[model samples]
Target: MVSYEGINNARPKTWATAADEWHALAKYSLDAAKDLREYGAKPLKDNWTDEVGATAAAEFAKLADQLEAAYDILLSVNMVADGMTTTIETAHSTMRAAVDLATQYGLEIGVDGTVTGPPPRSRTEAEEMGPYRAQVQDLVDQAVEQVTAADRLAAAEFAELAGQTGLTDPGKALNDLQTHASHVQMQMLANDIPVDEDPTTVRQWWNGLTDRQRKDMMLAQPVALANLDGIPADVRRELRGNGKYDRVKVVEYALANWDKGDPTDFGNNCTNFVSNALLHAGMKEKTSIWGTSDDDSWMIGNRTGVDGVDKRLAYSDSWAAAENNQNFMLEHGGSEVPRSDVKPGDII
Candidate 1:
């Protein structure tokens, strides 16, 4: 089972000190080897002017180069491990702060991941603390998620590092790490991540990212361009909607006018709102029983006749009710979509 006890008990400073010593030793050793090759081996070989001496010097120089390279790789690995330790230590402190806040609220988490509480003394206090408790709960949830991510990252990186490289070449180690990171990023981009994330949660996370990061992800992970289950439909619509209609304008109009009635249906305004939205979206009036007075057109206007003129601007009952609107959409250029498959700008 996953636990935060390691974070709570981490002695990162101690590990950091060890890393520093190791890094210094590696660098010092590399410098010493270089010095020995340049000052002792090379000079001695040059003064000898013998084939055996030259061959021995050349071999010593090759050994020195390998030694330097090995030390360089060692230092690189030590530096990375040191940085990771420090970062995780900081993360641990942050999580501890969250736990402190939870303690202040008399909250206790069981091993099974259930939270128990010192119940509020009274209903009034409970009521007052409800919103605050909700906020705290969200904070704790986010903290837990971040901790889990950190654990996974640290473990996976170390495992990959161990398997992929030896200290023979520092540059190769660095290159392999970068290549692996890029491959993992691409895999994440193509995966159905949004389908797994909560729509509100994903939207909030997206909003929190920097603009450059957002652009980078969008370019790198185009698969997320599809409105998945985890992203809010409205958010998707804003990002990917066609410019043929001002969706915001129409939706706002519907919200503002849903209570208002029309001449045809003075008591009901469902279809009127839908029709108004369609009109604002640039849908044109149709002929052949497709008007306010006709049986088909998605219109809303008038109904009475004035002398020789018919008040054709009114809406008909068949075009002003919810069921009628539903049928109209079904018969038109629209199809019924399941809630899971629905995106923004789609008619319900």
Candidate 2:
């Protein structure tokens, strides 16, 4: 006789704060690993004995073990939460179906399908109610199994990760796994699905992103790839929509229309144009990074560099002095204009 409101109010027991705590702990453990590595790397002339190094190693190992345990617990909690969410969803659907059937047939059925009025005394009568009773029981059983499996899977993944910690670079491996988990959690959140505590489910979610999204996600590649020669496929897709790009055509266009003397229209032109373009591309006032020096002054709060308009003006003056009047001629001419009319190399 559970009320719909009560069922609707039900939530997973796992706390996001707890997950954050575990993640923090993992980060600390990673720092400890780095400390251990630095300690071990000290000059041989320091004359470190086997016993001392062994003791330090043992302590680090113990910390790693504790970290692994915490990670496992985190995964388990997430799995249970996921299971609870799934169970609730299934139960709601089942209840809705049952209510619909009852409305259609004009009969009330208990969750266990026991008739309220007139208990069936004879075996023949009980036999007649078997199908309905079985159907309800099956639904309940399925829900229970799913929840239980989620709990078990979470526990298993935690144990496996813990066992591997000692043999592998625990910090690096776990951090990678954590990144993967975060991506999975993001996807689940995006879809309005609850992230389960189970590592398996998290892993599955990580493996399920669209190829483009997956490539674009920072977690998918190492930071070292940032300065690589070619752009990532995901980045190219985002920039050009399709992969077909005429590099020669783009280069030729830029060179043919390049304005060498104008300071505002040269390199600064791209930044100004991009800033405005980004605003027009649906970025709001907060997100948009463009405007005049007063409206969008990049130097409003921070003075790490010179103030915005002043900085540009200073540069223009310096360039004009360096180029011996060539800059002023271009500035007075049609080189500088609004962003829309400017090509790739036009000054702002």
Candidate 3:
């Protein structure tokens, strides 16, 4: 749990800086060990066949490999440090803002993250402080959630990154070391996300993350995240890589443009908003085929009016109505999933 006083006094950047220094030193040592292998060990093993020279070269190679394993451990430590720094900074700032808001609204917050109503002279004043106190409590809770999640994730990551095990193959000794860095990055993303499936909550979680944190999650589990709603279009694009219709982009665009339609949609309607997002994400549009019933096709037709500044828009029911759009997508290779299987980008 995060407290007001803890948030005020915590220095996450200091921890991150210390970790970086240690990483730099470890990298330097790793480079030196590599140098030993190349210049000291390899040359001796290649040219000196005598028993003493060969034994010394073998020892140099073994010591260099051990140094590499240590370096790998330090590399994982630096990764965790950076992740913790971002998490702590975000939580601290969130808690501080809550406190500031409480002060602005005539509420009092204690060091233990308890929000209290202001001393009101009248019943009306007391009633007015209720919302302010609630807001402060929300922020405090958010900070605690963020920090507690980080604490749990960091513990697991440290254990995995620094675990010692028996090594049977000398050649495979560096394999675990080589893979730890990327695995540690994925571990950094194993945080507590909201289970309520609120789009706003999910988006807030995504936005609060640092770039490295975002990228690591993106690279580690792009497909799963691509299905997550509330992620931005560009990140989803990077996740998909291919030029297919991105479900993440579709959801993002629909939510952002629901009330007011963009030029691409040309209709200030809910179905139009969703269709625009689908088209923008590379879903092909269908034209009128049979008679021009709104349900006969799924397409947006735009035209210029006599007054050039004024434009007119045409749409089929499938493109402008919710029920029709649902039917259209269902007929076009989309299957409905159970609530437990719902992803961020699901149409529902």
Candidate 4:
């Protein structure tokens, strides 16, 4: 068992407090300059004509400018620190939740972030734990990914800021950020379930999934479609759901509601719009590979959820995001075609 209590809190809230103090110091510097000009320099200028007084007043003005610049930098620092803290904390929360779920299912996470379990002595026990083990493993993997993503995002943002402010060698900082970004990109590329794998191999794996496991995972992890290979092309074509589809209607509905989905309300809903278009084109919603709930296999709800407010049209990120949409299309009898070959109603 791992004690997830204090892996990292992004240096606690102490940094934020320190930032407040720096802000106050900046203000004090500005106020002091103001007082020197008002009660000291201005009075000297009014009463006595001297180069020394003029120089002192000019210096006070310079001091005030420096103070304001310092304030701006300190504020930027505070914002960056706060943002990174929030990101790391969110990662910690997600990691903790994953660990808890794994533990609940009798799984243990090794220090390396791999998942293990209580040794199963019997065939029945092994069989029963199979699906659960996969789920726990998935959760652990996700937790690791969340942490990595948080680190990369923070690092990249910091590098950008540093480069902009010339605080560090911009080239070096940007190179480091690029390395981190590339690593993430490569990880994702390596994990992608190649669509070109043999249909037979894909089918065997798909067939091995228990019916309930299939439904649960499809709803819970649509990304699996993008990462797991070995389902017959025809099966993937059905989108794990049974339905008739009219690509023309899909296109028509999309054109009709071109600006309807609120981009501000949800993350870009292009995929969600495509999914709805398929539905409008007459693809039936199936629980196994289709649904409208936040965690359903595939769906964007008809309306946004707002308390005491009239319902507004809404959609799910999975249904609307490109990657998931591409997975859905590939699994459900769609394939990539050449740009020149595409017809007006065809989905890209």
Candidate 5:
């Protein structure tokens, strides 16, 4: 019964704090386990001789096992809490973004995940609103259902470990066998996740993973995970999509197109050249249709079409002036890198 309002209001910071606490507990447990082995278990095994000594050794070994179990239990809790923090944050950000898009289209998502469009005055208005309503509904529904599943999946996992004492006695032989079997099981799961699969297939597989498995798989196979599509939308947004920003293309365009022989290139055209390189590097044009064109309009405006109208008035101000271009970049996917950290093919 989780809803739009629940995710929208959830505090990710608190989850982060909880994760930190669990990590601290795990560290303490690990220290205790290590201490038991070093100061207690080892010494007992090394010196224990005959009947009484052997009896004492057996009891101490059991204690060592319990301490190791305690460390493992705490570590598992820490890992889950850490992973859940990321999951909850992603859910919150995605849900809020969906809500914002819904609002943008004059639609409202109810607390129970219902999409309500604004009342339309005419049949034409109703027709226009239909697609937007459907889009928002799909987005909101997917976001809600995915997050709910993740939450419940994590809850179910936690339930299995509930009330189990971190430091408890368990007489066992399957412990070592269990560990090996679990490793094999996890490896099998990892192998089952297809490599170089179509993005749709990859996304579907990723969506089916529990939150724990997602975190574990990412840690275990980062290179494969990096190649896969459908990473968290917020993380993906930070990247220029599909490796579109190619430095090689930027350099190539710069070398081939650098010239003042054209009539439009009267004098300095550093930003113009940069804009051309950027276009070759796959930066999309933001003409008046999209934005960054308040002064005048030029069809297919940029360096390639700079000669069509007045040179100063022909192109995007962002496509010509260094300052304007920098500002536009900052507003877009670009970041203000420090001078010392600036790399080649980066806008100066």
Candidate 6:
């Protein structure tokens, strides 16, 4: 029979660590229980004592139950830890990408002499600031999208693994993963080390724009106005009236106006507009928009005649695994976008 005393003494320091240990223990327990059953049955031919046989049978049954419980705990702990690891790795990658981008754009240093390696260099002259700010903002926006995508992938994988492990209650496993991922993401956002661009500086620069300059900038990009169907009518109107909206303001508008109908239904018009804006600004063709909802439309869909098709809906039941389907979009150039190089339709 399996040794209950040994098993009880083998408890781990933490639930996750314990789960790992019990996973191995559970397999060993099952093997031991099987051996005991076989040995007990073989002695039937000898007509063993009733008390001894009953004890053996009861012990084996108890071991089997214990093994099953241990297996469940193992699955739950693994799922939670896996989710946490994925989120942490994704956040680190995003921060690195942003920093790299900033360095490329010459924004590697702050006015106070602090090193901010990845953003583009600041444009000292007012005339040179707008485009430079826009470029930097675009890179930041892309980084945010990538981070969000990573979060979603982590969540989905955790859920799938939990189901595969034959856990008695997979819902708890999924919830734990979600909580862990959220906590990691929140920590990353809170740090705000300014990898690609500084939010405060960008805001100040935007506030300095002249009405005419803003109007000219707004009028230059027909793509954003025409294609962003997901944008609210009022916000779209505001954008149309003055092209000088700051990068953050535009993103805020997009987020605020996001349609909630379908979780994965990336709205057609608005996504295209955002994608096109990035393309015009020299962002790589693979750059995508990332968000939690179905309609947030980054680059995961198939395009037809310059418009993206709803592949999720079109192939609902036949969807490929996420890892096999979507290519991770890494930042191409350095973090900061220079003001002079900023295209009118640029996202940031």
Better of 1 and 2 by TM-score: 1
Worst 10 residues of 6 by lDDT: 1-10
Go through the candidates in order and give each one's C-alpha lDDT.
0.55, 0.40, 0.65, 0.51, 0.59, 0.40
Clashing pairs in 1: 199-230, 290-297, 301-313, 301-314, 302-313, 302-314
Q: Local error of candidate 4 at 13, Å? A: 3.4
lDDT, candidate 2, 227-260, per-residue tens: 2233344543343222123222333334444444
Collision pairs in model 3: 229-344, 294-317
TM-score of each: 0.43, 0.31, 0.55, 0.39, 0.50, 0.30
Residue-level lDDT of model 1, residues 254-341, one tens digit each, is 5566666543443445556666676766666554555555667665454464412332355554455778778777777667878865
CA lDDT, candidate 2, residue 323: 40
Q: For residues 84-129, write the lDDT of model 4, one tens digit per residue.
A: 4443343354455556667788787776666788899999999998
Ranking by TM-score: 3, 5, 1, 4, 2, 6
lDDT of 3 at 16: 83
Q: How many residue pairs clash in all the candidates, one count each?
A: 6, 11, 2, 11, 0, 28
lDDT of prediction 6: 0.40
Q: lDDT for model 5, please.
A: 0.59
**Between the candidate structures 3 and 4, which one is better when assessed by TM-score?**
3
What candidate 5 gets wrong by more than 4 Å, as runs, is 163-348
Instruction: Write down the lDDT that model 1 would get.
Output: 0.55
Question: Which residues of candidate 1, in runs, are more than 4 Å off?
Answer: 110-114, 119-348
**Candidate 1 vs candidate 3, TM-score winner:** 3
